[model samples]
Target: MTYHHLTIDELTMIANFRDQGVKAYRATKLLHRSLETVYRVYRFLAAGHTLQEYYQHYRENKAHCGRKAIQLPTDEVTYTKAKVAQGWTPDTIMGGHSAVVCGRFTAFSSGAILICGPCR
Candidate 1:
């Protein structure tokens, strides 16, 4: 399974379980997590930290305001547009990747060859 960030509630639960004298194996069963996860939680608590502290640290480490816009490269755009005007479809412009061809065509329409690579 793909790893997901541990939730604030899960962290709280882990810390609370450890404080209640629950062993890591039993804690794992309760939390539906692996023993390693329980071990990490116990270690964190034993280090004199609280669940809130861990969650806050985690949030600060990964917090971002927003995603930056994706800009097409200038020369890539020019070349793609030129190729399109010369009767090349997005498929040909992309050199035959059907998935990429469809996405670019849908986004930019047929007239503009959307450059799919480095500006050259």
Candidate 2:
């Protein structure tokens, strides 16, 4: 099943139900969510966090939870720039090489290199 982030309304409902001393299972049934989801929401509310605060915290936490970004080494970046300036096509530079710096070439050809702080 596809995962769905809880809506603001759902979070409000969870807070309201918990304030009324309702059980987590009952809140789950009312919201058509899982018991764990209900409990997690309730816990956040019980910790004196506002709905917006909870949402912000969730967003901040999830922002860093994805795959780490790939960074090309400084030497490789210099070499790619020199090659491009020497009239070498991006395809030739990337061909038979394990280095994935071709994306930078495409960006350079499209005049994006100036806008990119690292590439510049």
Residue 65, candidate 1: Cα error in Å is 16
Can you give the lDDT of residue 7 in candidate 2?
A: 76
Candidate lDDT values, in order: 0.67, 0.71
Error of 1 at 97 (Å): 12
63-102 per-residue lDDT for model 2 (tens digits): 7754443455676667667877888876776663466543
Candidate 1 stretches with Cα past 4 Å from truth are 60-71, 77-120
Q: In order, what is each prediction's RMSD in angstroms?
A: 7.2, 5.5
TM-score of each: 0.54, 0.62
Cα displacement (Å) at residue 93, model 1: 9.0
Q: What is the lDDT of residue 48 in candidate 1?
A: 95
Report the Cα lDDT for candidate 1. Answer: 0.67
Q: Which ten residues in a row have the lowest lDDT in candidate 2?
A: 111-120
- The digit string of per-residue lDDT tens for model 1 on 3-105 reads 6667888888887888788888998898788888779878877999877777777788657433433456666666766776798865676764332423564
